[model samples]
Target: MGLIVTIIIGFFVGLIAKFLMPGRDPGGFIITILLGIGGALTANFLGRALGLYSTNEAAGFIASVIGAMILLAIYRAFSGRGRLTH
Candidate 1:
């Protein structure tokens, strides 16, 4: 139940992030889901570190999207799949 909800939300988050940051990304549905989930986790930890969220609190939607975008950027940099485009 909770997991399903998370996955669904993650999918949307990933799609939104990708749409916002236009570029050639790797993988498909599964990667999108992972990206979203990873973004949320990144936001959670980053928020906690920056005192934006409490220990047990989660990140907001906007923050999650931002995090996802950051993750996607990093992925593209490391994967070298979205560079050198004319």
Candidate 2:
């Protein structure tokens, strides 16, 4: 149940981040969901390590979006794709 909730939140966070970023992102819904989930998890770990968040706490919307963007950027860089743009 908790995992499901986290995924759902991550999905929306990914979509929102993509929308906000206003760029071309490779992949479809599955990719978006994965990106979101990855971003959330990354943020969660980094925040905890930095003492910016509780161990069990989820990241805020903005942080999640930023994380997603960063992940997306890294993906593009590794894949030799162009930068994302509106």
Candidate 3:
């Protein structure tokens, strides 16, 4: 039950992140889902460490999206150099 909810939320989070940072991203739905989940985890961890969020309060959707965007930026930075646009 919890897992299903996570997946569903992850999907939407991924979509929102992609919409905000439009570009030629690699992979499809699966990747997007992973990105979303990763983003949420990242935000949760970082926020907790920084005292911005409590254990009872997981990172919200906005933070998740922001985290996804950050990951996307890093992905592009590393992968962009290896690919030829032309």
Candidate 4:
């Protein structure tokens, strides 16, 4: 139950992040959810390692969005598929 809730929250977090940073990416509801969850995980892991976030704390909404945006930036830089072929 808790895990399901977490996923739902992650989905929304991803949606909001994507909305905030609209960019080229393979996108859909599923992808958004995955991105969000991945971002949250990334933020949590890095924050804990850097002592910015405690182990018991999950990443905040803003942090999660920022993480997602960073991931999106990296994806944009590497994926190289969004070039508008004219």
Candidate 5:
């Protein structure tokens, strides 16, 4: 049940991140879901470390989206992609 909820949230977060960033990202639904989950985890970890969020709480929607964007940016940087244009 928790995993299902995470996936659903991830799906929407991925969609919104893609919309907000507007770039040629790789992968399909599975990839997007993975990205979303990764983003949420990253946000949660960072938020907790920075005292922006509680340790036991999940990241908020906006934080999740921002985290996804950050992940995308990191991916682009590592892959040598200059900018996203799509």
Candidate 6:
């Protein structure tokens, strides 16, 4: 139940990140879901570590979206598909 909720939220986060970034991505639906989940988890953990969020709190929507965007950028950079061609 909790996992499902997380996945759904993550999907939306990932979608928003992709929409904002507006570029070619390495993967599709499954990748998006993974990216979102990863982003949310990363934000949650990093925030807690940095004292931005309490241990009991999860990452907010905006933070999650930002995290996803960062992850997407990293992914693009590593995959060597981030270059623009004319």
Worst 10 residues of 3 by lDDT: 77-86
lDDT of 2 by residue, 61-81 (tens): 778878888888787788766
User: How does candidate 5 score on lDDT?
Assistant: 0.86
Write candidate 6's Cα lDDT for 1-86 as tens digits.
Answer: 99899889988999999999998886788889999998888888888889999878989999999889888888888987788767
* lDDT tens per residue, model 5, 4-84: 998988988888888888778898898788788888988999999999888678898889888998998899889877455
Off by over 4 Å in 4: 81-86
Clashing pairs in 1: none
User: Tens digit of lDDT per residue, candidate 4, span 14-66?
Assistant: 88888887766687888988889888888998889989988699888888888
Lowest-sum lDDT 10-residue window in model 2: 77-86
List ranges where model 3 is wrong by over 4 Å. 81-86
lDDT, candidates in the order shown: 0.91, 0.81, 0.88, 0.83, 0.86, 0.88
State the lDDT of candidate 1 residue by residue for 1-86, as single tens digits.
99999999899899999999998787799999989998899899899999999987999888999999999988888888658867
lDDT of 1 at 9: 87
The residue ranges of model 5 lying beyond 4 angstroms of the native Cα positions read 83-86
Highest TM-score against the true fold, candidate:
1
lDDT-superior candidate, 3 or 5: 3
**Which tens-of-lDDT digit does each residue in 1-63 have in candidate 3?**
999889988888888988998888987989999999999998998899999998898999999
Model 4, global lDDT: 0.83
- 10 residues in a row with least lDDT, candidate 4: 77-86
- Comparing 5 with 6 on lDDT, the higher-scoring candidate is 6
